[model samples]
Target: MLSTRRLRPSKNKPKLPDGVRIYAMTDIHGCAHLLKQMLRVIDADLARSRPRYAIEVYMGDYVDRGPDSRSTLDILIDRSRRGNTIFLKGNHEVFLGNVLRDPSLLTDWLRVGGLYTLMSYGLAPSPTPGDEERQHLVQAFARAMPRQHLEFLRKLRLTFTCGDFFFVHAGVRPGVPLAEQQETDLLWIREEFLKSRQNFGKYIVHGHTPVRSPELLENRANIDTGAYATGNLTLMTMQGSSMLAV
Candidate 1:
């Protein structure tokens, strides 16, 4: 069955260009099943709405945690090839790349669920890998990772802007201008961005810090529903000045 929840209209509703629709998603955390389910719902919604143009903005964290990280990337890569899609980099993805480049970071990466991702690529990661083991694991991962997947990860964007919304994996820095925002803050910031009431130039649509449900604040919207653990993956659809969570 189709699932959707209309957002309560805010006084100053953000608008999209006429006839364009955006389906924003975030924080899959390697849950391929949930991602597939959400994609089906988006497809159904698109069939019914048939807007002039549509864009799917993925807020990243597509790997790590849960299971099936490989399949998750497979699905997303395929989707991107099919049509209009924007992929943003998330902190977890940063960890993946960092560990690949510098094996010394494996211990830190494993703590935040990088093991699952390694396992999904058919490499069994030791819970506490030593320096030598870390190097071996990284080598194995490089061999196991598909060329396309590596390319996709390397090419991910930090932000995507469309009309009145700025899409990112995590919240932007509170005081930084959108163009001047740093990559670290864009992919990792939380407290300051969430706590501040400062108006970002555009309506911020992001995910990284998962919420019990989708939050549609006057300034921003968070669509991360902790899909890996809670089995709730959020897809926020935006068109004109209306937003709906599915």
Candidate 2:
């Protein structure tokens, strides 16, 4: 995998030009190649659009369930640091953060398919890898992982607003302001948000509860299509309320 350590950025990441139209992505479960494909499409669209703007918000899941979590995080951080990407936290990141806090959580994470992340970071499960081997891979991956990658995961915003839209990793708790949204629901919600029929006031774009394609609900959209699992990536064009498959 391409090292992400070099891709990490320093403090005060630059902001995007919010006035321009945007294209968003979510639940990128470590499919590094698919992300490249998506970027190519975004570039083509940007080149053709009048006035030439770029993509904006992206929902997260940059790790786990795929072959190249390290590469995936590296690319997203690189693009966002370039000032045209907005990233929201997904449940996978939250789980990784938890594991970092308590390595014992590795079982829970492993149960949820986080072994790919451990492998990306150069760690192993049962009969933990030998020290020399572990240290070599760890140092290599650590050196390559962008520091901002962890910072990005650490300070990931649960909710953000751009124009009339509110973007989150997962849906908000019903009746809660974007300001008061619970982090748990933001990263892990599925049912309550899915079952709700009322308008959520501001339109929400999120990824969670994977589908074959973007699931367009009356109030929000699910951009997760389980790309890593199904070899399909779903995207929503911020240019308008439209879905694009890559």
Cα lDDT of model 1 by residue, 70-135, tens digit: 999999999998679999899999999988899999999998999899999998876898889999
The digit string of per-residue lDDT tens for model 2 on 77-146 reads: 7787778677778888888777656555555676776878767766554534444544454455446556
Error of 2 at 214 (Å): 1.5
lDDT of candidate 2 vs native? 0.70
**Model 2: residues >4 Å from true position, as ranges?**
1-19, 50-53, 127-146, 240-246
Kindly provide the TM-score of model 2 when superposed on the true structure, using C-alpha atoms: 0.81
RMSD of each: 1.1, 8.8
The RMSD (Cα, Å) of candidate 2 is 8.8
Q: Which model scores highest in lDDT?
A: 1
